[model samples]
Target: MGGYDGLVVLVGVALLLTTGRCDTSCGGTDGSPGVAGTPGRDGRAGMKGEKGEPAVKAEGPVDEVVLLTLKGEMGNRGLQGVMGPKGYRGDLGATGRPGQPGRPGPDGKNIGHGQQSAQQGHSAFSAIRTDNSLPRYEQRVTYQTIVVNKPGDFDKNTGYFTCRVPGVYYFSFHSMSKVSMCLRIASDALNEKLGFCDYNRNNDQVLSGGVVLQLTARQKVWLESFRDQQPSTDQRDTRDKYIIFNGFLLFSNDPELHFSLCGTGRGGFYFPVCSVRLPIMLHHFVLVIGALLSFAVPVKVAMESCPAAAMPGIPGMPGLPGRDGRDGEKGQKGDPGAAWAGGLGPQKGEKGEPGLMGFPGKRGQSGEPGRSGEPGLSGPPGEAGEPGTVGTQDRAAFSVARGTNEYPEKASVIRFTKVITNINNDYNTETGRFRCRVPGTYYFVFHASLEDRLCVVLKLDQTLLTSFCDHRRGRRQVTSGGLAVHLSQDQEVWLETKDYIGMRGKPTGFSIFSGFLLHPH
Candidate 1:
């Protein structure tokens, strides 16, 4: 069967080749195609054949120009090619235009519904004591120097600041004294103390204190000495200012309210709008009564209108509306209308009671969120806070000197009795020793006038810390020594003479002893 099929294919190819050659050589015309033929039955399926060999290459005529062309079926797509190498980075693009403005935020709720009614009040005063004479015990300290007295509330002669406006006020005082003094800031109206300062020394020292007070109208504030203590005068410079007192209002609690007229008229005054809506008979009666009272009682007209120099006040609030009138009697019903139009209407009935509330409807689907709004403007800054109180720690210091020159006293402590500056009272005038209250490092120094051989030793709790000596023959000489030592609480430190002593003190020699805390533990 294979041989027979191969023979038929070879014969068909040979006949097609011969016919094409003959037609080209003899130039014969094409014959008509035959159509009438009986149909044949379908043949059986054949076995699958092996792969065929590729066709050999054939060379055509060099210059054979073919005019007619036939369309061919499209071939299957080829496999994808290899990927290309990575490309170089591209140049940056130009910047885009600015975006549109953002949506505006919602309006804020109003705080106060009307215009402001009052302004900030201001009242401040500062005075200094000028008289050097001592006052009687518990007397008020008077001031001859008036630095500033805004609103003229402070009376210099009486040394008292009388309150005219009710508000919070701050008061402070500074005094320089050479004697033990107790000064206090007191309210005269209440006869109560507000603040005080205790300064005890025999030399010049400054003491200061301050306090804040909430005061009412008619209250008075002044400075007074306690236990007959006197703030001594500054002997060196009489012109130097001392004993200064200051007071100022921080804020007010009351707002001023007054009536104002709207038109320029001599007899016009402020009155509510509802008062002018009276009936004709009532108006006549009020006019007669006003005329009768005109002669006996004076009618002070506190009228205000457009001013030439100052801004006007805000107008008063409006009055309430009048009441409704009574209803009239009902009328008869009307006749019916034509058929093409609407029929007769029903009469209006009285209002009925409200029905029960219905169930809530279903929630709707959520919408896309809106864009964010722009930021709001910043608010004004807040007010400053009040002054802080004074600290009491880390304030240990002293300065003492001897008043009388004394002779030798072996194995004994040299006591300097006169006090100049004993801030925390760490030094003892009777014991001639310094007791530590706060544990810390301290610096101590002393200067002694010697007429003959003298030796002084600094001791800490019976342990020698340092010493100094001076020798001269019947002639005055000076000796000084100092040291920085660490001390603990309850430790005792003092200066003592050993073997020989010639310590001169006070007015003639001016010997002194001083010490101060350097750092706290």
Candidate 2:
């Protein structure tokens, strides 16, 4: 069919074919596009399609969010997004720059002050500040000082004052005769009477003596006066006239209207200042001068300057005695006595044994003529004698008889009690004891002496010893004719030095050489 010629035919065929699409094509098919089946009527349109979730939108560096309301109809839900992977960390920020600096503040200048000025010599802390018109306050002594005297009255014009440190005090007081001046000091926080300077000089003189007082820091002290006797003069006027103290000075730093409740009666300065100020180093000089002056009071003790003395020479009498003439030479010693010079005698033993007759003494130079004997020739030497035997000793042995043969028996000196008789020695004091063999009175003498402090004291037990310094040197002394000592039986007499003494020769011994029993009474 070429275009127009088949057009109608094709159209017819298409319609027929379309009409027959539901019919089965072959044998036994369950479902197919065959003409046998017819189309069911269109079911109600399927429910409208579910809507999707709107996409989230984002802008630049910052994030944006939106909110939406849900519709009343049901819808299919969208899937959730997966979580993102972790991101890398960012770097730390840089440190900041430092800030700037700031500006500076006033000048200080010193004004006027004092108390530290005279620390070198001839100086001490002045009582008043340098600004004479002003008083001291709030300030204290920068250095330590000594107070010469207390500056307080009996709490009259001054505030109560306390001592600050302990030291010696020098004080002065002046008053007339028959009046009493008393000084009062407070310690342990109470006023106490310290000392009294009673002026009892009806002769218009002053009496002064020292009293020591001890004080400590912040201790209160005061001075006062009293009239002891009933004087004809007014006591109050006399108290005002007195000024008797000078020891040490204590002070307070800052001065105000306040003062030690003190007064000096009705007077000039409570404690006047001597105008001269000295360097502190010169303080020793002041002390020396003050000490000198203090010691020089009462006229008798005044110092007298004088020249020095020469050294002393050896002590001796001024002139020498006449010299003695020299003597002749001494003779030589004589030979020993010849053996058996005299008639032979019997041998002797010790005192216990019968003593042998003493060998006959050398022959006396007598005039007796001897009968002549026949002349003989010389004889040969005799045989050597045998050694003599040793002798035994005895206890309580008596000494050989003593003989004073130096001088004639009549010329030898003798003592009854001591070696020196009172006639020969002065100051020789001696005591004697005697046993009465004949019961008769005896004549006795004393020999006592003190050879330049070598004193001799004599005493006897069972007897009254009487002695005194006769002061007569070198003599035999007898008991005073007026008083005498009588003794009987046995008595022990001894001598001793009255003081620490040395001896000259022997000071004591006794001998009866011619001490005769007599009727001395």
Candidate 3:
């Protein structure tokens, strides 16, 4: 093994020594370097060579120059090494530009609400009478100035509202007259009158009345005067200032029921037959389709082979038997019945003897009870009764308004001077307190208008019952508070500012303090 190792080392040195022969030998410059050849295929690994003996140590000194010269140009890079470990994930990529917007979708269909709105069933009418002519007895008051009459149900010429839809309606009227006036709201559907309004004051008088009625289609309603002196209208005052009639449908009972008066104004009564209305859109669509069909098929042939009218519906069930009819008039006598069957052809039979009278016959079970008797006449007035005991007159009530704005000291009672009402003089304006006259529960309320902050407390004899506060920046504010408290006789209650005093008063009574006795214990 030592000899073989030495032989291999000497052979490698000889190759190295011959590699510089071009530099040492006298040879012309070398030709251009040859092109790189394609790499050779790797040979299969051979069996493991036997381990050489331990390297022998050389005895002479090793030259560093020889070692340096033995090194050759780096061999071609070894076959690509196995793939390295996966690197750390790279930073997130930049955001991409937005794409062009997609085309708009087709137009959407109109969707109707499943539930109908409350405003859809609107039916209202308003009118004013400006004519000075007085209507005759039992005549309708004509309102020529028609303010609003939706659906054209009101007849200004006849002064009657003929119903077009069945629903509950509210009717109201206001009349101003100096002379006596009496009006009646009448409906043809009902036997009794709806409402009445009477004003008999010699001075200017106003009267108003309202009524709610359930009306059916084709029913006529109007305001009429049955008395001799009807409500006089003013020709000067128009513009709905007086003698105005208004009516509106509150809610509908049936939305689809419609009627058409047939054979009206005949010798007999008029009958209104019900009808159903189809959608206008549906009718238009059906007409279009029919026109197209008529064009597609020759009109001459279509008309020649026209279909027969639809067969009538099956007859309804038979009704119940009618009531018995009245008797017919008697016929004329028939020649005296042929002289009583040959007159006296046969002789009269012998007269029979009279039978004996029977007893009373036990009263015949008293027959059926007689009907109730008519009401008796009212009796004369009775004598006057004795005088009764007097009621407790212990009452307390007051309503006062402030006349000016006040910014009182802290914890001061608010003085209300302008007294609107003071029952039994229980509220003292000087002290700004209501001294209870009767021991009972009393309710007190106060309203204050302010431009700044305000905190008020309702005090019952120095004990606060409740507090109210209103704070706003720019606009005026109003605050109201109420409380019911039980008070003994002479106990006082009043309104006062708690910490901040802010209040404004007006002649219109914007600030008010009122208290009333609910009951006396």
Candidate 4:
């Protein structure tokens, strides 16, 4: 058949097959439908056609069949069309609000209170009692009674107060005696008397002494009658004050509160803020505030506002003049002047007769020795002298020999008591050790004579430098070992036996440990 007739026949057969399979009327229930396929991607847009030639003016109406026939099959996909013009940039996104602030962290630990309580219990105490009891001179005066003991720092039995803290402390002592007496305040910590009070009258009198000092922990202070003072026999009521000794801590040496509250030039007191009691600080603070307020107001205005000042009063008689002060000490005598020479204007008279010799004046005491003067500047070094005959170099050298030929115990260090030659005294005969005075290379030798097995070791400081062992038993066995070692200054070396070694009863000086410095580094 012709090509066109064959195609037409196939088309007719396909139509008939499709028509026969289609069922218009409903019959049995339909089977479940298969899942729909995914939609296909849309085809890319076609390239724009050239501007149409001026629209043709057509008198007849356009025909749809002609337009449909004009459409052509799609050509091979053209190169990807140019990307569409970029779209207008969108408005910038609104900035996000700042995140909320994080919650505050927990508070730090409290340090002020802990520092303030470090020296909370520091205090001083003292008292005096009178009941016909007298203490011997040069002895500690016990009050036998206490009036105030804030911290119990003083011991009534010992009549002494041991400082409990390292800080400044104030001590005071008072005594009442019927007869003339002297009292002394002494401190073992200072190894001397701090102060003394003396009453020179036979009638009853009071003597007191006080001292402020920086004391260290465990330091002791006390009051005692002066040596050789007469004992008092006067009887007095118990209520009468006689003797007392007391001291108290001013402040501690806590570093946390170290600061000067006032200037030392004005006799100011200084204390650690942490060591001061709260009550004392508050009291001081109140005083400071009151002082500031008082200074801020006008004194004259306040005085005028007072009722007493507003009412005038009659003037009183003047007070008598004060007595004149005692005379000052006499001045020292001046040395005699040399005789003047006669002037040329007039001739001098004959010299007077020699005056009678006055009794020899008492020999004046020798003057105290003068203090040593500072050292003078060093003189320039002298020129080198001519060279002399060359001699052996004086290298540090030492040799030791056994004093007694006796067997050494097992595991004991062998001591060389007899030093044959110690040029530099580097070897200690008592310790049997050689200490290196100069850093250098050294040669050490150990010679041992034994009849039985023995092991010897040479140790430098704590390390073994060399060792020797001999197991043979001979009538006269000799074992020798040596080592060349580098030693640092102050390093020590010695020889020790690992096992028992036999020795001749006679002093042969065969066994020896010796070392010599080869060259200083």
36-100 in candidate 4: lDDT tens per residue? 44554554544554433221223333333544454444444444544544445445445544544
lDDT of each: 0.61, 0.29, 0.61, 0.57
Candidate 2, TM-score vs. the true structure? 0.18
Of candidates 4 and 1, the better by TM-score:
1
lDDT of 1 by residue, 92-162 (tens): 44444445554554443211113221123457899988655444447888888889998788998998899
Where is model 2 more than 4 Å wrong at Cα?
Answer: 1-156, 159-161, 166-192, 197-202, 232-240, 249-521
- Estimate, for each residue in 1-521, the C-alpha lDDT of model 2 and write its tens digit: 37886898989999889656524332232332323334334444444444433322232121112122322333334343344344343343343333332222122211113212111101111121111111112112111122322333222223223443333222222233333332232234333332332333233333332222334445654334333332434343332222333333211122211223444222222433335667665334334343434454555564343223323444443344334434434434444322332333112222243334444444434344434444444444444433221111100000010122121122121122322112112111222223333333433322221122223334445333543333332321111111223434343333333432322212111011112223322
RMSD of 4: 56.9
RMSD of each: 44.6, 67.5, 60.1, 56.9
Model 3: per-residue Cα lDDT over 1-521, one tens digit each: 99999999999999888766634553433344444445444444445555333212233333335434544444444444445455455454444445445455444321113322222445789999876554455788887799999868898889899876565566667777655455666787555553333334345555554445667778988987655333344223333224788887644453332224643323322356556788665333333333434345555533233223333444455455444444444444333111223222223334445444433333223334445445445544444432221133544566676767566557888888877557567889999999988898887776665556788898887887889887653434445677889999889999888777777765221466777766678
How much does candidate 3 score in TM-score? Answer: 0.28
Please give the TM-score that candidate 1 achieves against the real structure.
Answer: 0.29
Of the candidates numbered 1 and 2, which has the greater lDDT value?
1
- Identify the candidate with maximal TM-score: 1
Better of 3 and 4 by TM-score: 3
Between candidates 1 and 4, the one scoring higher on lDDT is 1
